[model samples]
Target: MAELRTLARPYAKAAFKAAQEHEQLAEWSQVLTIAGQVTANKSIRQLLANPGLEEQKKAELILEVAEDGVTEQVRNFFAVLAENRRLTLLPEISALFNTYRADLERTVDIEVTAAFELTDEQQQKLAQALSTKLERKVSLAASMDKSLIGGAIIRTGDLVIDASVRGKLTKLADALGS
Candidate 1:
């Protein structure tokens, strides 16, 4: 998984640069997402892996399977990927591209798991507070996890705040064991 992301990073960066230059970040994002979904199809992936099939043909097949509105630049991007035999990396490329887009837009996705459901007002307040703390727009998704016992866990990117009763108990156990 890490290797795939490493290999896909350059392609994703190149696509991001092109989209930035053309002021078509949103369009390119959609194009990459559609292309990724197309490549994720098992049958399509097998066909693309056929040694007898030409690179251009594989790229053409993807473009056809993808929805309409793909621009000339996006088609060319596909060709490059097919030529480099990196078409299989589309899923990673698309994810990286979206991460770049989110960073540029100053937005972060947050996940919250708690023992119980959070009300709309509570969610809104949490989002606002996180937005202020992170200095970025927050998109929060809340879920109930009774196993947590009480309190909640907040996760965003590489940061995690584990405040649940289960987490506390585990910590206390570790400290006592040590």
Candidate 2:
């Protein structure tokens, strides 16, 4: 994982620079996402590994088959990856590119975990509260956990707001122990 990040950094940086220069960051994001997804598919891996196919031919076939939004620039990048045998790293590249996007946007993804699923109004209120507190828009990813028993926990990077019943019990237990 760490090694993959180290191996992926240079390629991601190069691709990000190219995308930024051409004002195609968003477009490339989608393109890379699709390409990454394709590369993740077992059938696609098998196809890429076929001994009967030429590398460039395989790449071209891929370009045509995964033709969701194959722009010339994205095609060139894919060709470069194909040539370098780095096509398998598309998922890491996408992850790095998203990190770049988040850095550029000064936003972080927040997760809100609750004992039960949150309603739309609850989500909106939580987001609004977070936005006001952080002074930046928050993208909320949420999950339900019955083990939490009650309340919700909000997390954004180093910040955490744990209002869970489990947390409260832990606090009570700790206090009694102390």
Best by lDDT: 1
- Tens digit of lDDT per residue, candidate 2, span 37-155? 87778988888887787777767866675667677877787788778877778778888887787777777789999999999999999888888888776899999999999998989
- CA lDDT of each candidate? 0.92, 0.82
Q: Identify the runs in model 2 with alpha carbons over 4 angstroms from their true place.
A: 65-68, 133-135, 155-163, 167-178
Task: Report the lDDT tens digits of candidate 1 across residue range 1-178.
Answer: 9999999999999999989998999988988898888888898789888999999888888777665657788888988998899999998999999999999999999999989999999999999999999999999999999999999999987899999999999999999999
TM-score of each: 0.92, 0.79
- Cα displacement (angstroms), candidate 1, residue 94, comes to 0.7
Name the best candidate (by TM-score): 1
| RMSD of each candidate relative to the true structure | 1.6, 3.0
Tell me the lDDT of model 1 at 2: 95
Clashing pairs in 1: none
Q: Model 1 residue 160 lDDT?
A: 99
Q: Kindly report which residue stretches of model 1 are placed more than 4 angstroms away from their true locations once superposed.
A: none
Looking at model 1, report the run of 10 residues with the lowest lDDT sum. Answer: 62-71
